[model samples]
Target: MLIMKPRILNGMMICGTESEMRYCDIGELHKDFHLGTNTTIDFIMDQYDSGFLLELCRRTAQIVYKDIYQQLQQGNSAVLIEHLQYYLDREGGVFDIKTVQDEISVNVSKCPMLSHITSNGETLSPNIGDFLSDFYGSWGENTPFIISVDYTYPEESYCIYIRRYYAS
Candidate 1:
């Protein structure tokens, strides 16, 4: 039996067949529309259009990496130290700010499709790792293909969104 996997990160959701995964950014496109980044984009494709969604995912990453990667590369000791301090304070994983920055330096096409098979009526919620564990069933023997980011917004309700890409 084939298994299914899904990964979400950084406000992007990529899913669908292995051969042709679809990536999307519902929130970014919404903001882009309001900002008139491209007035003609709407006439070309609506939110439901997978192509439009994928484009948003690609474009958003371009914007993010371009804006942040270089600043990290500058070796501005103060800024890097500040970020390192914050990560350490939070008990996050050990990571060098510059190294992390380098991961997202180049564009990557990370797909977020939740599973390999969509049979039955079982639609896995993005929050359920158990549902996705199937993709990693071989004790990490197989290539790691899916991941998710869990975040809590201070003073706001809990929400789970698939992080579409990982810099690492």
Candidate 2:
């Protein structure tokens, strides 16, 4: 049995064995997904308050953190920074990660979601910062690490500093 891997090539998602390959137009899918996500976010903001959105982001972060934690426990061998780098690279985000001593800094020059949202002529929610704060805050819960984020929505740029905490 041949193992099939999915890859992106020339704006197409290619998958399946070499004998028979399947191709999907990544451009169409990307546009549709971004539009749907932007619309959903707008609808959610219109229907609920910012606090509600923050809570949702927090919960999502907790879930993701738990999964990463579990993977680490199973001897995945990848560090948190590596996981973050993988996510950003896969999501089409332009970012740089640097580690110094016990601290890691992630600088995102182009936030894919935010860029897509703004490109669609949609206004960002005023509570975007609060949402991000809650998300990263919750993500570090129950861990010996913490993350701080500073972002400019208009420029779609952000800097995240991740530091290890020690209980002395």
* TM-score of every candidate: 0.20, 0.68
- Model 1 misplacement above 4 A: 1-48, 69-148, 151-168
Error of 1 at 164 (Å): 15
- Point to the candidate with the largest TM-score: 2
Over 54-160, each residue of candidate 2 has an lDDT whose tens digit, in order, gives 77766676564566554433433135555566556657899998878777788988877777778878776555666556666665666667777897655677888
- Model 1 lDDT, residue 12, Cα: 53
Candidate 1 lDDT by residue in tens digits, 107-133: 111212221112222343322232222
**Local distance difference test values of all predictions, in order:** 0.28, 0.63
Q: After superposition, how far is residue 94 of candidate 2 from its true place, in Å?
A: 1.4
lDDT for predicted candidate 1 compared with the true structure: 0.28
Q: How many residue pairs collide in each prediction?
A: 15, 0
